[model samples]
Target chain A: MAVNTIHREPPEQSAYRGVRRVDHSPQIFNNQPARYYLMWLLLPAVLLLAAISLYPFVWLIYMSLHEVQLAPGKSDLWAGVDNFTRLFSDKSFARGWVTLFKYSALCLSVEISLGVLVAVILNNSRLEKLFITIFLMPMMMAPVVAGFLYMFLYNGTFGWYFWLLRSLGVLDGGTILGNKSWAMAGIVATDVWQWTPLIALITLAGLKRVPQEQLEANMVDGAGPLRNFFSVALPNLYPFLLIAILLRFMDNFRFIDTILIMTGGGPANATKILPTYLFDVSFKFFELGRGAAIAFTLLLLTILLGLILTKIFEDPTRKIKTDGMD
Target chain B: MTSVTIKDVWKYYGKTMAVKELNIEVRDNEFLCLLGPSGCGKSSTLRMLAGLEFISSGEVFFGDLKVNDIPPRDRDIAMVFENYALYPHKTVFENMANPLKLQRMNKTDIKERVVWAAQMLEIEELLQRKPVELSGGQKQRTAIGRAIVREPKVFLFDEPIAHLDAKLRSHMRGELKHLQRRLETTTVYVTHDQLEGMTMADRIAVMHEGVLQQLGTPGEIYNHPVNEFVAGFVGEPPMNFLDCRIEGAGDSASLVYDNMNLALGGEQSRILETKGAAREVRLGIRPDDLTIEMGTDHGLELSAKIFVTEPLGGDMLIEADFGQDRMTIKRKIAELGQPGDACGIAVNSEKLHVFDRDTGEAFF
Candidate 1:
């Protein structure tokens, strides 16, 4: 009875069953390795990057070896290593690197410490979202705009900050920008005001990623608030804090617009960091060759500093490992 | 060790009440399990005891000292969370030594205690490894080891073994029970698994929807559940409830369903008579208490067709379909029959449970 009731194909399907089968192998284009195809797909983006960034960088290196002339009739002269030699001999150029080192160190340390404090406080605050939004307003503004705003605030004649500082005995009579001793302090203050929020936001995101249960466990383990912060929260936040510091350090190394617009390396060149000094040598002094040499030196310095920072802070052991069982 | 008492404790998250007017006393060195389903306030009660959660009102006492305002660290209680809550960055020895370190204990003594705990938990070899290097059961053992190393006044467990696989969970259950017995600490364990509660707890406090359903020893909870929920919840296969109506008020009273009737026994009728058993009542019976016969040669016979049969090793669970209701009956595997077969069901009268339909309160 089972054999009689077995399923049988229709006459049309049975007739076509004997026909030859077509080959279904992939075509030649599809047979190639996936990475080979991906390389072809990414060629356009690579070329675009070279055109915009790599080509200009190469051209700048070439121009640094020669004395470039902007006039159409004047021929460019081979200066050899004269531009590089002049960068080291120039007193303002030497002072620019020193000034930048000091500024980057001071600004980064202050911003990181303050940012972590603010993030911790705000993380525990009831109005965290509202306060975070308010704190981030300065970072959203254009750097040139912030520079102009601080320039007005530092004006001795009608600026409210100047008047308040004078009333408070902080500044006796001189403008903060015009005074050689106070000019760098004013620039650092402006940079801190505009950039501290970025570090705080990054640290806050890291703080939120901390497993809440671990904090509660610490409480049960007899850890007070301060001990909990040091033993549990801080260890978990190490990677994020390091990343924030590295990014802030790199950004501050090349800092230019605020100081350029506000001080213009003025007041006896007290605020002339590397980037501003390069601007002065290239545009103000019309010495493009020496400016390019300084730019290249700054790039090398940044790479060296970045490598050192990464080596010190980018240890993968900083991450808290979990068994992934949970 | 000290006794813990919760008096009129209410926990509220904003306006929503998570635990309502709870009162329980845990004697010194007693193992008490707060048993419930999810969102049933058992964890909240345990957390309140641990001082991890704030009490909205009322007082928690640790041997006459009110601890409503005391922080968790000062409360002298250790907790094992469901996720094991081991510090990922710390090794097992460090995790176990943390509490002692907080108390400014010397390195030698902290190491001694941690080693002792690790040995007791059979995790001495894992002491050098971090939590990330341990498996689920090993991590749980470390968590327990950490708790024991503190020698706190009380131990709170929030479903600590709920994440383990079945075999490992059962194995760890025995280990935890034996360990608690040895330590003699006042322990409050929370779990949604009834088996864990029944097997481990000296006294089981069953809760439902933020209210305590019943609190008794395992035997008492199983045999004399105060309400329908407790009866249904405390059992493995759960109690079967059949809707019926009471007919004839006096000695001739019987429970009647569609075309079927069961005479009320003397004790049950007397209790129902005094309680004024409403016209409608639910017949609650455990699957194990129901006897199945191949044919009708029994007292209070229920004609039913077998819906399905699940062979559970020694015992077979059969779903029997009556006129409009289905009930589960446990039978010996050797006596099991196929589905669609007609069978006679004889309910054990002494084990029968009757609840008022409206209030769901068990009468007998």
Candidate 2:
């Protein structure tokens, strides 16, 4: 046998023969260190963030410590903790937190359920892209505009919905926004209409990422559609669902605009949620110190809620492995 | 176990026909492989049998039942996808026990069955691990175990081991064949690899362009391909083909290519005359059937220059150029050859294949 050895040079040695290595030493600018350049590069964004976010936050804290009279002849006075003390004693302020909780819970639950149902239905449809675009129209509309549109539609005299409710004997010709019992329900309905599509869009993306093979395997394993959803599809959608719910929760927690435009905290403050109360205290009655106090409290609550949700989202097993490093 | 029969089944995706007029019967406890290249409809036919895909027309029967309208779950079939398809969030035990749980079986029985399948696949120790934590081969075993725990009427494997490394794939091939035999279930496997099909299947069905080209045992399919496609597709390094013309009739017929004239054997010549074989045909020969020597000594020998030599462990594959045509010959490693060297080659007339040039159908 004539065996010929095909001698080939090592690839790295041949390819690198004429090439020069890149310098890894730190670079300098104008006789300054690399950190100086980094600081300069970040200066614009840092300054802008400070001007917009930090400056306002510090001013709010400073304002919360002093009572400033809106009257031209009056002077500002140091209030110490008096404004915060008033926050606890104010009945409307206490009721606002309760209203905020109820609204967030109701809106988030209904939105997530309806969004998942829509996403699942659209996932199997042949005209998925067309229907998805159509379904997303509500979310594309500005929330304040949607609120105004719903307000006109909920009017007792000429609104189509009011007439339908009266014909159906559900409302007996009463205005949806004017009735105390239906005021919160009307605001919640408007929020659901405008924001449910956001949840649906995210859920649809998650549904698309579910492996087709796994679903087929489920079918072959004797799972019906319902069983497949519970065992396979639902588990795969958890991470995305969690994210969607968290976003909706946070947004609903600070909700104000739609309620402000539609109900204006009417019908004996039935729809007076936290942000609406904040607006009423700060701009309407001009209680700048107490409004700043309420604002600071809401910020703290948001941060705490975010931390708790993030803790829940972390996988316990992954957490344990990371904790072992300590 | 139940035998599966597909009768005149056709599948269409939009306007494109994926599987056309397919009819096949997988006997009870039989291991049948659907073998073809990509887009050849082998996977489509298997999916139809599994009831994962609807048959565009015709019927599929399991034993005495016509299952054309039956869903996959009702058909009592289990499948292992190419990606394994083990539930990512579930432990191996949960994955294996899922089918039994869906059947509403008791907890103890489900556990026993899952453990038994795990042991069968030699993955008992990894039963508690999630799919993401296991290696590819282990994941494949879990998928097989999931199917096994179902103990369904038929097992459908859609290139299940295609993703594994070569060594693991070969090992799993043997394991799957043994497991299927022990379980005595009717199994239909699909793969584009001819080697996997030849090694594992009791019968091989070769498809091309949505049409079944040939159906036979591995030996029969390799020895007697019905068309040029199967002949070219089945062998390692593939069979070499030369454009040639058949002249004369009966026993005097000969194949003429370039300046070489080779007389046909008696059996081939008789068969060709009966078929009214086309004058323009392709002469097919496996590289293993050609013999190369240092110089021409026989009347049937032809002279050619060696183009290249590839040593593939056990044998040397030589590409020899005869005029403008090139044909590969598998020779013993002891047969020394260099590029530009002239060698005499003789084809084994008994093993030669002849096909119509235009239609690609074999004459015999």
Question: Local distance difference test, per candidate?
Answer: 0.86, 0.86
lDDT of 2 by residue, A1-326 (tens): 10112221123454656877765866754665456688889999999999999999998998898897788998878999888888878888889999998999899899999999999988868999898788789888887888889988898878887787778888853589988888888988998888888889999999999888999999999999899998888888877888898899889877677898988988888889988999999999998988999999988998898778777765322332212111
**Segments in model 2 whose C-alpha atoms lie over 4 Å from true places:** A1-43, A65-86, A126-130, A172-174, A310-326, B294-300
In model 1, residue pairs whose N, Cα or C atoms come closer than 3 Å (at least 3 residues apart or on different chains), thus clashing, are none
Q: What is the C-alpha RMSD of each candidate to the true structure, in Å?
A: 10.0, 7.0
For every model shown, what is its TM-score relative to the native structure?
0.88, 0.89
* lDDT of predicted model 2: 0.86
Could you tell me how far off, in angstroms, the CA of residue A227 lies in candidate 1 after the best superposition?
A: 2.0
The per-residue C-alpha lDDT of model 1 at residue B14 equals 94
TM-score of chain B of each: 0.97, 0.97
Task: Report per-candidate TM-score of chain A alone.
Answer: 0.84, 0.83
